[model samples]
Target: MTERVTLITGASAGIGTELARVFASNGHRVALAARRADRLATLADEITAGGGAAPIVIACDLEQPDAGDKIAAALAAEGVEVEFVVNNAGFGLFGHAIKLDRDEQLGMLAVNIRALTDLSLRFSDHLIRHRGGILNVGSIASFLPGPGMAVYYASKAYVLSFSEALRGELAPHGVRVTALCPGPVPSEFQARAGFLPGVDSLVLNVSPADVALAGYRGLMANKRAVLPGVGIKIVPFLLRFFPRGFVLSVVGRYQLRKR
Candidate 1:
């Protein structure tokens, strides 16, 4: 019998790569998509060397307008129906919104928000038709308004909100939509966001392996949301009860103090 196929965005590194590992270990034939094809190739090689299934690598910049169409076409041609999707490709821009280039901020939004939304909808449709599942990678930052990283936080908030709503809509169709809200994991993210130099102590962060395993299990079980770490699991509940003003004040102080 042919193995199940799962398409994972951002599969070149970090959470994405770990997610691929989890899925492949569970007997899924994975399709890896990321800008770095070499990285994906290396990861696939490692998986196969370890006696796990090798993933098909599809390299594409998801920020590009044609990325979604391209990926969908490529998968179809390869005869790999997407049995599951993990939308994990995203980035952040730190510093004041005015100080950052407008183009960069918008580009981050394009990737983090637009790409995620497009992938979710496309995969949701496929899953609804095929009885698949989806896991959208959100962030703990989504639960609070980030002052220094305003656009990034808002984009994640959209992710958390959308995942919840999508879960409700797709549940009856035997399609599960899981929102993965992780607090922090050491990865390429901090360096890219220009926040690497300032960080002293890490927060209640979980390993990418832990995050991926928890998220994968939740997605497979059709859980509505998966906040991997204990800290993150408790945060959204607090954010819901706290008034917007209080939450903002707390978030603002936390961020500004880092600078």
Candidate 2:
């Protein structure tokens, strides 16, 4: 029999690392994928030492067009089939759309949008056969229009919509899909985005470990979307009361302040 495994991308650090640990502790054999081979190796060792099955570490940049195919091939080579997929590999840049480097923004889309969609749909047969699940990491930005970080916010919006639609399509097949939307997570993400957290971030921030646990629980419960904190859970609800223009203005000012 082929071994069933959970495939988690962006497993090198932050919420992705925590998600891997949580899944492994719950008895899921994991496949860790990230650009950082050393980080992945360390995480693999930690999981094994903690009595979890050793993880298969695939170190490849998701920016490549064939990243999904590579991940599939790696798993096939090991005789493992995916029972769960965590599309947690993504990044953002904090700047006005016109001001940011064009190539960098497009690269973000390659990983955040294209690669995520590829992996989510690539193993549909395996997911159906195993009655599996998918957990996609979106952001609070998914619900709002961002003026400064336009492309990044839009990419997460795609994640939310795509995950929901995919969930409906797969529900009858006993496959659960959940979008994990967090707000202001303190991680390498802020650094890479060139963002310095301000008052808003402090108000909304949740620890990466807590976010991962919440995402795990939410996915198991078959929730359509998991917002990890009380602050985050209120965001969409509050968005309902505000006009789109007003919300856009607010986000625009916030991003401008960060810049």
Candidate 3:
């Protein structure tokens, strides 16, 4: 049997960190990857203290084009065979597309789109060979358009679409692909996305641990998508029935800068 290792990206904080904890607590050896090496080390120590095997820490900046290759190389160097991958590394920018810094917007695309795709494809052979699976962190934003956070919304849309398609393609091969669409969670995402304080209250807040658990369960079940909260679960149905323009308008208003 192929060795099973769960590789979690963006493991330094927030949902990614929580996901790592969940997997580790379940007795899964995880490889934690993020730009924050120090934070990864701390998490590794915590997991170890909890009696889980010491996690492999890899400091990676997924924004670089070659990040997927580097991660593969690093894992191979450690003799870790990834049986499960959590593509939980992504960020967003809040603003009109034209108003946001071009480089920053592109950087968001690089991390949120390019890196995820690259990694998903990069490990496909291994996953299929081992009957492993992938869990992609999407968002409620994936269900509809956001006029203000245009690029971010579109990126998540891509995530949802890609994950669904990949799920269909991989299922016959015994590989599962699950898209985790979570509503607002108490995480660093909003702050890093440039939301002003209190903006996160625009939606119900669930804990990162809850989201991670939902994702883990859904992935194991091989579900196509996992919507964590009640509010989030209603999103797809609402989007299907709502008028597109009306939905876009509401999102525009919601994303408006608050004083």
- Ten contiguous residues minimizing lDDT sum, candidate 1: 196-205
**Model 2, span 202-247: residue lDDT tens:** 8988999999999999999999999998988888999999999999
Worst 10 residues of 2 by lDDT: 250-259
The lDDT-based order of candidates, best leading, equals 2, 3, 1
Instruction: Please list the residue runs of candidate 1 whose C-alpha ends up more than 4 Å from where it truly belongs after superposition.
Output: 1-4, 197-201
* Model 2, position 104: C-alpha lDDT score: 98
RMSD of each: 1.9, 0.6, 1.5
Question: On residues 1-259, what C-alpha lDDT tens digit does candidate 3 reach at each position?
Answer: 5467899999999999999999999989999989999999999999999999989888989999888888999898887688898999999988889988999999999999999999898888889888999999999889889887899999999999999999999999999999999888777888888776454455656789999999999999989999987766877887788889989888888788542
What is the TM-score (0 to 1) of candidate 3?
Answer: 0.96
What would the TM-score be for candidate 1 when compared with the true structure? 0.93
Top TM-score hit: 2
The lDDT of model 2 is 0.95
Kindly list the per-residue Cα lDDT of model 1 for residues 137-225, writing each as its tens digit: 99888778888899999999999999899888888998888989888788888878877533322556789999999999998887888
Error of 2 at 84 (Å): 0.1
Candidate closer to the true structure by TM-score (higher is better), 2 or 3: 2
